[model samples]
Target: MAFSTITNLDAAAAQQHSHELLDRILSTASSTYVTGPVGQGNGERVLVLGGTGYIGRALVPELARRGYRPAVLSRSAEVKNEAEYADAEVIVGDATKAADVAAAVKAAPTAVVISLLSGRKPNDVEDCRQVDHEAVVHGIKAAVANDVQQFIHISDYGVYRPELIPQVYKIQVEGELIGQHHGYVPWTIIRPTAYFPYLSVAFGDVKNGLKYRIYDHGEWNVVNPIAREDLAEFIVNQVLNDDAIGRILPVGGPWNADNTVTLKQAGEFMFELNGKTPDWEVITMASWDKKIARLGRLSKLTKQLKPVVFYLEAAKY
Candidate 1:
């Protein structure tokens, strides 16, 4: 069964709630495909779009260890020499092009196709549409034409309540998949929370005695960022599984003090870990809004400031 965990309760209560919820889910969960561990791969091929990324490095090897034949569709042939991709066959291709995606699917008789594709720039609307929405649609169409058994999409938790340009495209892709916009295809959608790296972006700065920046109060939002390895396992678990078909799973890391924290708490932890007193530069939302407005005006004159606007809006979110 598919489910999402909410971490809106107090720290202690949230931890206990997560534990109880997980226990209940495990006790009741059932899968239609349970013939063998990792099911019988039988050398069945699985095509992965965006397989040169951070999560793909972990996911490709896991699929190999589990007996599935992983085929990575990458734009760079250099991935062929990477140790992580050694276990899988690398098909050089650009996912943004429909013909390239179709050729990758047709290269072998594939059973499953998974997409971990997203734009490099979140603020660029055109880039987001091309990579996040159109590219994924290309993969989906390819999978449909090839009669692929399953198509799994790695979406973001932000799409649950979309505000950003990237998230908007992600939501659109989800709608197309669920509504059979192209053709009938069994699909699974995963909405994972933030990754640990995103949360630790300022750790080095804090260690260097830079004042930690935060919005007013900094307790407006809380997140539990999952590790790449953990997220990879979660995604692989759904591959070729009948129960996972047409399901949307929202997952996160454990709800401990270190894993679950607000923006303010994240900053405090960094300072404490670096053996320094908390030095926070809190910006009032009103002041931040003014800056964002200025950036918005500047973005129209040049493309460089679009990312700045996105980052500001994302922080406020």
Candidate 2:
């Protein structure tokens, strides 16, 4: 079960599981049974790790528009200057590299560190661990070294214990950080559910035979979505809200899973928006497509994991 109790767990496994569950609980907002509201932000300098991905692209503009300054951490020039952080400072740095991470952190001594990087590739779990898990450890160290008052990490809603949903990656990032890093600065963590923007496209393609999807069946878990502006709003809040420190916050909306509909349904909505007939079909979660071959499932996994399945278990929204 998710977060059964610590007494029943051994150290290492417990550490990993606890870390995961904490992340889930926060992202899913099980405490309030709410997805999460974008934070009430404070205008301040922020170091955004993994600020080149989809969420980052959507989030950076909000950071700038809302009065908070965002600095991006990128190892690739392509990912760095891809119109994502046009308004913010772009720093060439790797989150996992201690020196690079420290240099970036030191550049803005008073800023908060927000981690958005983690294992995203199939063959890159370890790499993700190195950057997401270990590099975060380094960031905390840097935060303390730089005397920053806050460390805000962008975590996921998926990490938690198995069994109740062991198929999921079930483990909390918060636990991993505190247990492993012992951050010296006041810290804040943001855990949000899947994003609606990408899901609209991914699911539409999959159901159209453009791709195969992955799913075991049923909707045991739910999708928690926050708009890019909402995410940015949360970041702004994190920067300004001094009381939010040392807390893990999850943000979502009044409508979560209910708002999360089937691909076909979503497609119809899109078609209506396009002033056309919705011609998409609902692909079986386990359906297979030959064009992308197994890669179809891989692509679907990214979307499914984004809102549905992880480690093969359903999300407990």
Candidate 3:
């Protein structure tokens, strides 16, 4: 009888130990479910504006993977690829339209609203203003009306110093977005440097046998380009973290503080990605200035290229 009692006690201890081990393994495997103060778990509804764009396409999937339900608002009824958002709810509507924005916001009482809208071109100042500034204002009003808890606005790092003519639109929009949030709801603004895809323009001339153009020998300015997927992950992870509320976060790629890429380095990286040699041409500031001046004052191409010239010229600083 004494032996049987001891054996039963030992089996009970062994079962408890095994259960604890399983618990630890499950906790480690389910890291994404670990919620912060703002996180309401996987059932939280998130509304994403401009969800059909480059960044949004990645962001929606990342949100879904993290167990948050995401609903995307697009101007078109038919998404280019339906399977991409199989888990997300797709609402067809134009953000610029007040009614459409309201309908999407009210579609579900969202815990967070993220805006990834951007202008298609640098020279289209009116379109830029409308989409980046006005549409955001409208979206904010809609979110506010629906009692959304948080708002995340994606802005460019170039807006920090608006010396370029095209940056004015971004500057204005950033001001409106921050001003409108005004303590009513928690707002987080993310300013990201140029994305890797944006700098891939160097590849455009590569196939034509044209040497990649480098300004000031591509050594003056440095940029830390972030991958779109990484940026999307950062944004979605911050959604429910109250610590990120009202913070202006500047993010970069996985490079050390002292490690940054210049235009030449970026071009070389792209060339190497395509398994080709880095052929380069250096364009001096003086040569670029002369070319711009020769384009004449009333030329549309010149107007469109002003932002490019401004960026290259500013890089020398």
Clashing pairs in 3: none
lDDT of 2 at 199: 59
- Better-scoring candidate (lDDT), 2 or 3: 3
TM of each candidate vs. truth: 0.82, 0.65, 0.75
Best by TM-score: 1
Between candidates 1 and 3, the lDDT winner: 1
lDDT of each residue in 71-152, candidate 1, tens digit only: 9999888999999998899998899999999999999899999999988777677788899999999999999999999999
lDDT per residue for candidate 2 within 24-104, as digits (tens), equals 555684343422344433567778777787678867777777677788888776664566667888888777788998898
> How well does candidate 1 match the true structure in TM-score terms?
0.82
Clashes, model 1:
0
Candidate 1: residue 183 lDDT (0-100) = 99
How do the candidates rank by lDDT, highest first? 1, 3, 2
